[model samples]
Structures are given as structure tokens and as C-alpha cells.
Target: MEQLQVKLGEKAQITTVMQEVFATEVGAVYQCNKRNRLVVDFANAQIVLKVDAFLRLKKAVDSIDLRDMAVNTQRCSDYELLTVCGCEKLYVLTLPEIYSFKELLGGAKFALELNSMLHECLHTQVA
Candidate 1:
């Protein structure tokens, strides 16, 4: 658990504990082990997702063809719509926003995989 102190008033303060999985200039992903949830903060919005839902969100984001979407002249192609299984919020993003979002997700995915690998290697008992 990580503790952070925030000042709300002269006599008010608060603290929050979270493990940051990944982050970019535009957003970040945080893991709350105690709650078994991932908190995604992006585009001025925050979403709480379970592990499976986070994976699904990454898959959905990866499937989008940014190049095609950018080159296409269709009006609908100007923006992309994204939704993750078990998540209620719909993400409507423009080309640049999509790029940033993709970057954030990709970084988070890499971090998660690296953590898993490290955990496995550290816990394995070599005979």
C-alpha cells in the first residue's frame, strides 16, 4: 500500500494507497491489490476494471487499425468507438486521442507482462 497526503482545507487532509502499473503523459493505470481491481485514469475519466476486463480492453484497443482509420475519408472514420466487455463506459476518441490511448494501453500491457515474468522467475526453485 502507498500513502499519499492531500490537502483539502487548512485542517483537512487525505491519503490514498495504490500501485501504479503504468503511466504516460496522458493517463495512467493503477492496481489495487486489496480490491483486485485496476483503475484506469484517462481523458479526465476514471474507470475501475477487473483483471479480465482490463485484458479485454487491451485486446479491443489493439484490434483498431489506426492507419486505416486515419487515411479513410469516411465521416465515421474520423472517430473511433471503443467498449470493453463488462465495462459500461463507451470511449469515443479522435485519431490523436486514439494514438495516445494506444500508447498508454501498450505500455501498461508490457509492464504487466514484465511483472508476471519477474514474479515467476523469482519464485521458481531451480533443482
Candidate 2:
């Protein structure tokens, strides 16, 4: 079987979108700083996010679509990295991150719901 490898750059784009949406809704100023420096040579890999960047990413993911994650997506296993070779970059939600802030602020619920829909649409590109 071929390895499942996701491009670091694609993942970064998803993270960036999530971060922007979360920041806009929560009034939080979040910025995605490039933690891993990638190169054209896909074989030579040295890409990894620092602790702070990881935390920010986690928060952004959490804030994206908590409701859908709880009711709809499958939870991703606890792995430092997800490699999806032969498959393009995609957003896989883990359950715990899905239903965070069960009781949301005004308009926040809609934001999360929209994020969920957006995520599903993004997944369709892989096929």
C-alpha cells in the first residue's frame, strides 16, 4: 500500500483559515507563523510546529466547528503527525475538539456550524 502523506503547506492553509475565522468570531487576534520550513525536495523533510504554534493550531481547530465535530466527524487518533500520501491535504476532526464551548455566545454557534460545512466541502476536493 502506498503511504498517506499530506502536504505541510496544505495543512497550513486549513489552519490559517480556521485561525482567521476563530479570531474574527471570538475577537481574538491570532496569527499563524510558519514553524516548519519546507523545501521543494519532498523526500527531505524537516517540518514541524513548535509548542506555541501547536497550541494555537489546537485552539483554532477547536474553535472552528465544535458542534459538527461532536455530531458529525470522526475523531482523529492521537498522533503527532498525519501522513496522507497519494491523498491531498484534508481536515480530519477529533471528537473532543468538536463540541467545545457547548454553550456558545451570540452568533458563535452559527459560525461553528458554517465552519463544519466548509470543512466537509473541503474534503470533497480529495476525491
Candidate 3:
């Protein structure tokens, strides 16, 4: 396994149709911050967000239904896009990048499961 320890204050270029900008540093797991946050590295950039924010992102990603899109566009030689809009910037992941993302999320499996359960509980309580 590769070393997953990402140091603080690392930066990566994030781009959109408009322009590209550097990512802002956020808290990482290696640090002692009790903010209920999950950190993932993409292209060497750290993406740190709270559990609630991550839950919202999960909702957005679910709404996209990439699997369905993949099935529909299987024959098309174009890359499918999944754009995640964070509070600071937008993260646009291509189909290949999505695979890396899946791996990163797998590292945070416990957090993902907990977030999913908490989300369901909140909805059930609300209803």
C-alpha cells in the first residue's frame, strides 16, 4: 500500500470552464481537529470537509447517478463528468478520476458508513 499521510498546506490546481485556481488548505486527519471532518487527496490536493458537508456531497453524487450514465453512454468515447461543488471551489472528476475517488472513499469506509446511517436516521426522525 502507498503512504497516505498528506502533509498540511498542500495545493493543487482546480479548473472549470471559466478558469483554474489553486485549492485552499483544509484540516487533515493527521492533525488533532475534532470537527467531524473527512479528508481525501485528489491529484495530491487535500479535500477536507465536515461530515454534514460530506453528506450533502454524497447526496449530490447520488443525484448524478454515474452508474446509470455509464450504462447509457457506454458506447460513447467521451468521459463522464461528476462535478462536486464545495463551499470553497468546484471539483470536477472525470471517469478515471472517479475510480481514484472510490479508492479514497474506501479508506474512509467507517466514516462513510456512519454518515450514511446518520443521514437515514435524520430523515426518518424528520419524517
Candidate with best lDDT:
1
Identify the superior model by TM-score, candidate 2 or candidate 3.
Answer: 3
Error of 3 at 123 (Å): 26
lDDT head-to-head 1 vs 2, winner:
1
For model 3, residues 32-123, the per-residue Cα lDDT tens digits are: 13334455445556555655655565555445545665667555523544445553436666655555555444435555467569989999
Count clashes in each candidate, considering only residues at least 3 apart in sequence or on different chains: 0, 7, 0
Residue pairs clashing, model 2: 4-83, 4-84, 4-85, 5-84, 5-85, 6-84, 66-98
Model 3 residue pairs with clashes: none
Against the hidden true structure, what lDDT does model 2 obtain?
A: 0.34
Models sorted by TM-score, best on top: 1, 3, 2
Model 1 accuracy (lDDT, Cα): 0.81
29-101 per-residue lDDT for model 1 (tens digits): 8877666777788887877788889889888888899999988999999988999787666999999988898
**Residue 85 of candidate 1: its Cα lDDT?**
82
Ten-residue stretch with the least lDDT total in model 3? 15-24
